[model samples]
Target chain A: MSTLSEPPKQSFHMGMLLNDTRYRGYTFQFIALLALVALFGWMVSNAVANLAALGQDINFGFLSDQAGYDINQQIIPYESTDTHMRAAFVGVLNTLLVAVLGCILATIVGVVVGVLRLSNNWLIARLMSVYVEIFRNVPVLIWILIVFNVMANALPSPSTFRGDDATASMLLGAFAFTNSGVYLPLPLWLEGSIVVVGVFVVSLIAIWALRRYARHLLYSEGRVIPTLPIGLALFVVPTLLAFFIMGRPIALEYPEMGRFNFQNGIQVRGSFIALWLALSLYTGAFIAENVRGAIQAVSKGQTEAAASLGLRPGRIMSLVVLPQALRVMIPPNISQYLNLTKNSSLAAAVGYMDITGTLGGVTLNQTGRSFEAILLLMAFYLAISLAISGIMNLYNNSVKLKER
Target chain B: MKNSLLLGAIAVTGMVAGAATADTLQEVKDRGVLNCGISTGLVGFASQNANGDWQGFDVAICQAVAAAIFGDANAVEYNPVTNQVRFEILNSGEIDMLSRNTTWTFSRDVDLKLDFLGVNYYDGQGFLIPTELGVSSAKELDGAKVCIQKGTTTELNVADFFRVNNIEYEPVPISTASEAQQAYLAGTCQVYTTDASGLAATRASFEDPSAHVILPEIISKEPLGPLVRHGDDDWGDVVRWSLNALIAAEELGITSANVDDLAAAPTDNPEINRLLGTEGTLGEMLGLPADWGVNVIKANGNYGEIFEKFIGENTPIGLARGLNAQWTDGGLLYAPPFR
Candidate 1:
């Protein structure tokens, strides 16, 4: 190693912004930052001038005004006399509902397809490949259209299910499927429903405790006790006993067929069904690939080692393969969930009253406040995407590998 | 990095603000093309033909304005816009005039600061339903599933109508007119509601047009016209009179065939002579040639001829001239005398 005894005499020069080693990065960054500011300032000034010329402003006062329109699918109470902001809130709720539902469904479908594709059964594996290929290659928009069309056309209209001797009948005499929507028996919460739910939750905790006790017995005592049956008993007995003791607090209101449609039940619009199903199926194909790759990434040696230690194949998979593969799979899976959430904005195509369909679309048109509406819309999407990633990141950290 | 990104955005916005700003008329003259905004594919209003040319009732207005300005009907470029972006596209100077079938509401005209030239079509909100449903009148439409195009006046109108009548209805709001039509036909909604003219235009394209019947109740008035951005009086006058010239031509019985001949020689009637540019300097006041009236009429005949050619009873749209006829004929179409 050469010992540097003395430093060269340094002089500040104007060229240091580009050529000097020590101060160059800061100088260059400053210059770049200045250029960017100038560019951005120029564009904003231009937009303001343009808006002024057009005799408009970027005001957002329209949110408090009465929204003269009505929304078909609103989770919250809304009327035509409600403010535009309330209408938008309803839209936000609808968007969240569909996004959450789509994510859950997409994950389930993706994992199933992924595992089945790697199955030893040749026919099942080939079928899974075909399903993935067909869904992965087609555009999500076309899939939405196709699914929406099927829901609208293939289903029988309510008039066909009207009479007593009607050709069309409700599923299980409780659910009605029509071109308008899928109607199901509405669940009514009674006086003791809360107690029932509490008992069920307690039963879940009891099952977890029972499993721990089983592990303790295995460690402390030489005799092994079968835990599955005991855990099942712990899971069901308390919930069932509480439900009966509470006199079956939850009652279902079955749908009654009317002249035009089924009444006295909850209805899910066909648009919602189509959008939900299409988003799940389309995103599932991509996630299937992710899951398959993650599983394959786990080495054969680990499974073989578990087998040599007298572990069953199922035990080896649950204890060794899944735990490792899940760590590799989680990060990509979070992104797929985010993708499904964002793609739910396409609900406008099928007339689902999501946030985009209501606020970004109808309200923007009605109010003619495109600048403010669009800015708010972009902010909403960014917030939602960031929030989702933030949550997933927290979950990911918990499941991450801990190296000693 | 974040600061740089923010600065970059500001710089881009500032650049856009510094973009070319000039008199729209002079810009049009310099560019030698009239940037006309139109709908993408509304059947009889603005759609591309097999020959790949934009032709419809709305397209004729654009061509007439271009003819009056440049003395060439073909000196116009069509920009297809959706309902959500039409106003921004016009306000941004991307288009010179919007000849799309936009309604002239009080808010749109005064609040949005747009100058509506003249009403080209007088329409009202109406309901179209499949005849198999056995519903005759709109009053019987309680608990109905209605399909409507979002971002339109019809959405609010239907809601008001239903509420005032103490009825409950579910609205399935689609984004595009085509989607609404598909939803209606596929029995997703029992009733499809829109402007009477739009219903005609949509029904005319159906495979079985007779299967649907339009309900009798007319809910709201929708006077659709061509418009331009406010604060440009010169450009506004040019577009307004170009439309007026068509109406006046129809009123005075001066068609495309007779406009040139009548402009060549003085006419017996003073109004016809003045309209044909043989009696006054009307065209000069709006910054056009002496033969502006003649060019406009010759570009797309008279308003009557355009109406007959596009949405008239003779066409597939098969619409009768109800409120669009002349004032003397007990219709609402009245043009100020070109003195």
Candidate 2:
């Protein structure tokens, strides 16, 4: 048995700050705080003195100055006469575009490969295992370089696409992949295309409502309503009807064969293609392992219980195993997405003018503002990473189980 | 406690500030090596040879400076920096002088606070294209994809050229010259544009050098040279005169072969006497020994000799000394008189 009582009372003294046990933790913490402040102060002071000696000052006035450089690809209107800020904005958009595209592609490839790796088929499982080993074991940078080289050497020249006796022909007579880039047909929005798109959105919401109604019927009246076929009808019937009523308001603009390239079409540059494919394949390998681990982490007893309850194998996976496996999979998957986004900075190696290629690179070299440019680059990447993690965390919270 | 911490911090920072403001010349002397900035590798301009020794046009300049200071041509420590980090390395005092192939521009001089001593190589932007392209003039390069070295004036120059000509072209900005060369050869781009000297160097390294032709268009002036920090006039003067000594040696017919003989006895040319440090105390004024000019010429023969040895028509690079020849030979290279 233990009892709490004041056995002795001692008077406090000046030496107690160092000797007394009760005040010891606070004293050490106070000293540590002071040391941290001093270190920071010393570093800042040294930086200030060094800058002064170099006749340099931290200036942001150059952001508004004319960039006087042309960018090959831009999503918005940009000219050489635009300001540095405008050029940087274009770079930021390009970076985001590739990162988003890479993440989506990586996720799809990862989930497919992850699930297939557990297949009972020996041939298929071995093939997937080989792919994962080769991609995951090699450095991502080397993979990027290798992919870029292969694309550069393997693709036919644009000139080969020209003339009646052309050496290379476009696949499906629409997509042209050349040494420079890939060209594809773009969608031409006719007058009533907006109405057609609106109808499609309405149909999607109607399908969701139909599924909810089916679930309510099953719960309240013990009457099982077949939702899949009705939901499919809701998904297609309105959209098809709207398309005809609106005079089929979407048209395709095919890429026309030109002397050097396929003009009048959308061009996806080879650098972007290489960077996207390399990042997806490399990151997908790691993500595949995460997915496999998560799936296995779901206990086998869950599947057995579902089987005993007369659930089919597919339904058991969808309704019982998957939901639980996803919770385990998503947290690690968020980190993979973050990794892919950060690795997109390597787009510079292939000349894809991402944020690092333009602002942190050429702009810094041109303006001699390394300190400011690097600081801004760090800040932008930090913000992007934190934003990705924050959004993923929120989604994770919604899917997480309630605990006692 | 906070007051004592503040006092200690101030003391430490004061020592750092003192070290940063130390005279670069004295520091170099104390360190016993002149830190020189150069490119990672650019054939005939700044690159290491097969013998694992640095030998190039820009390397000669650094050697000349080192010889002028210590009477030893090998007294330099070369720091090979990438284009993205060269200026920062120079600005941070990590290198004593930047002898890299850096172009002198208005902004680099006035805004970046760098003092360019003199232009050692007069290069202008030009284009290189494969023979199959049949593009003789830059005007024919309309709608062509061009490979350009990034972080340099070539990108902006090419952009301005295309825009002003009212022609459309795509720029594939590459990080290094080797990458640009690879991409151009791999058919990723139709044209490669850089300084004319750079084009020559790159073409010489190509597997089929004869299959490529440089377009006859010098679009922009790129006066490449060595530079130092703006406020350091004493060091700047030493570097300027060392380069001037080479130019002067070429003009006076005093090559490395004849430098010692020319300095042994007073000649009819008093300017030669003053330059050879026999008739005046010019080296003393620069805080160097009496034979500084002799050492500089001995390090690298002379401007013409250096040019011929590295990138002249006889060399693999085969760059013609067109505008780089001396003023007396109807070229732009004119040095200030030594008197």
Candidate 3:
């Protein structure tokens, strides 16, 4: 045993040497890591040197200074006397407003066009194909410009539509398009409308509970109840009763012609309308292609199996195809939403007071703080994109198939 | 590879040697060309015609600078620049001088480190609205949406003016003058704001020029002038005194027609002699030939002649030489002593 151990000492030394050799293989990776750190450090130092040379120290103190600029459309209260940070918040809110509204409208348009493009009717399919092809191929900026030009040239001047004349009334009632913007009636709430709204919320909960009960009855008792009708009744009955009890606290406020322009009701500027419409149309075209690809990605075998199980065509699509298609659809759809949010920045070109227009344009010019303005603008966009991705990832996870 | 390396070394040495000996003024003289930056089609300032030749008040300045440098009026290259990119281009040395209607402000001079030669045009920010709005004065534009071109001093002036007046305004900011004009015409904004001279230029482009009214309020001081990069003091002096020579020529009754005659025979006025390079070493001070001012006057008419030709009362812009007149006429345009 002593002789055998004495012979193995050299082998033990060889094993340690082999281990050291393996460790040396990672030296290249270590060097790469050090190189990356050095590159970043060099860049940071260069930025500091450049900033110092310009006598422009990077600080956020300017954000609290008076913005001294006015925003055309702000969701929150803003004034020229407000701080730049508050102005940035207003710009953020305006960006979110356009992004949210654009997403919802784009989704609706996308779904409709996507399904119509696969329709049995040839003419409708061809028309939707044209829409998708045209919008998807052209740059979004051109679409924005074209739409703005059309709105500017085609809409009647405000001076021509400021009276109760027959032509003016007819045109205003039909389209309500004016140079000031497109005016439409909004529902105005009176006193005690909160009670009615509370009733409506309670009814919605009841309707959801009724739907659950109906599903349970269908499974347990094998009795088919018209859940849609019962749900509708549960929703409308209490809301109507509360409306009468609260004395009908809602009224439609139609736009009325006033001196120089329209008064009352909602007035959306032509720039916003043109920009919103162009962004929705352009993004919806891309989303429609994604929807189509996702739908086609679902195996035909699933639909056939559902049909073999005696399900109708519509049920096969709803129960079998859509569940699987949605899994493939959500990731790409999130990216489209992000695209729509970023493209809304192009509204600046058309004079729409989105974040890029107000903060990046006028605020930067007024303050001469390009660094702060552009940094805030990029951060806002990044945060919005991350939020959308987070929500969509959760939705994708819920609809994803569990694989062995 | 060794032979190629030796050849590359020789080429780089030759290039450096050439660069070391190159004189900027002599290079310009030899090349017989001067690169100048001007506005992108402002009507009475600098604009291109259908024939693609630049003409107007600002263009004449470029021509005069070229003529001062190279004894020929046609030795100029004009590059159009917008407000957003003009300063960066000048700083990067892409153009020799910026003759666009740029407002000479404190920040541009000190912070940006540019040398504003002198105020060629005294202007101010003014508001313009459709006459149908019945707004005769800027004070009445309360709760109005003002269309302003972004990335310029005019935008800040608009905000400050509105705030000081206790008026609420929706600023519909745009990137270009054309966009502001379209927005104002389409009623997206109730009023359009810019320099008073710019308002006149924009209004003249309309089908009916009388349909818009320029508000009486001149809210901000805009001393529009030419500028060059900061460190080139010799170049700065050259541009400054060249402009002053034009003003001094007009004051001395030295028209372009009589400049050759006056140069051949010395004038009675010492200021004219110094400006025309007949007296003093002003030309030698700037490292130019003695007839530099004469060449400038020959290239373009004097300041008054150029202003009268482009934006005078008879022109479509119809701007009066109210504050742009000489000191003898009680205006602010007084040059420093030529000596």
- Against the true structure, whose DockQ is highest? 2
Ranking by DockQ: 2, 1, 3
Instruction: Report the lDDT tens digits of candidate 1 across residue range A1-404.
Output: 24466676677888877777888899878987998898778667766777776667888999999999999998999998898899999999999999999988988999889978998899999999999999999999999999988878889888788766677998999999998789999999899999989988988888888878877886798556888898888788888898899999989999987545677889988889999999999999998988899889999999899999888977887778878888888899988888888899999888899888888888888898888888988899899999999999998899999778
Between candidates 1 and 2, the one scoring higher on lDDT is: 2
lDDT of 1 by residue, B246-336 (tens): 9988988988887778889887899887777788888788878888888899987999999998889999899999999999888989988
**TM score of chain A per candidate:** 0.92, 0.91, 0.88
Q: How close is candidate 3 to the true structure, as a TM-score?
A: 0.90
Give stretches of model 1 more than 4 Å off. Answer: A1-21, A163-167, A218-247, B1-21, B48-52
lDDT by candidate, in order shown? 0.87, 0.88, 0.81
Give candidate 1's error at residue A277 in angstroms.
1.8
- The positional error of residue B124 in candidate 3, measured at the CA in angstroms, is 1.8
Task: Give lDDT tens digits, candidate 2, residues A1-404.
Answer: 23347655678887999888889889999998997897888677677667767777877788998888888889888888898888889899999998999999999889888878887899988889999999999988888888888988999977677777889998898898888899899999999999989999999999888888887897899788888888889888998999899998998888886533567779999989889999999999988888888889999999899999888987887788878989999999999999999999998888898899878877887888887888889999999999999999999999998686
Candidate 1: residue A110 lDDT (0-100) = 93
Tens digit per residue, CA lDDT, model 3, B172-237: 777777777877887777788889999998898899999889989999899998888776677778
lDDT of 3 by residue, A138-210 (tens): 9999998898888778777666775545344424463477755788887888998899899999999988888
**What TM-score would each prediction reach against the true structure?**
0.91, 0.91, 0.90
Off by over 4 Å in 3: A1-21, A164-167, A170-175, A186-188, A221-223, A234-237, A252-254, B1-33
Shift in Å, residue B36, candidate 1: 2.5
The candidate scoring highest on TM-score is 2
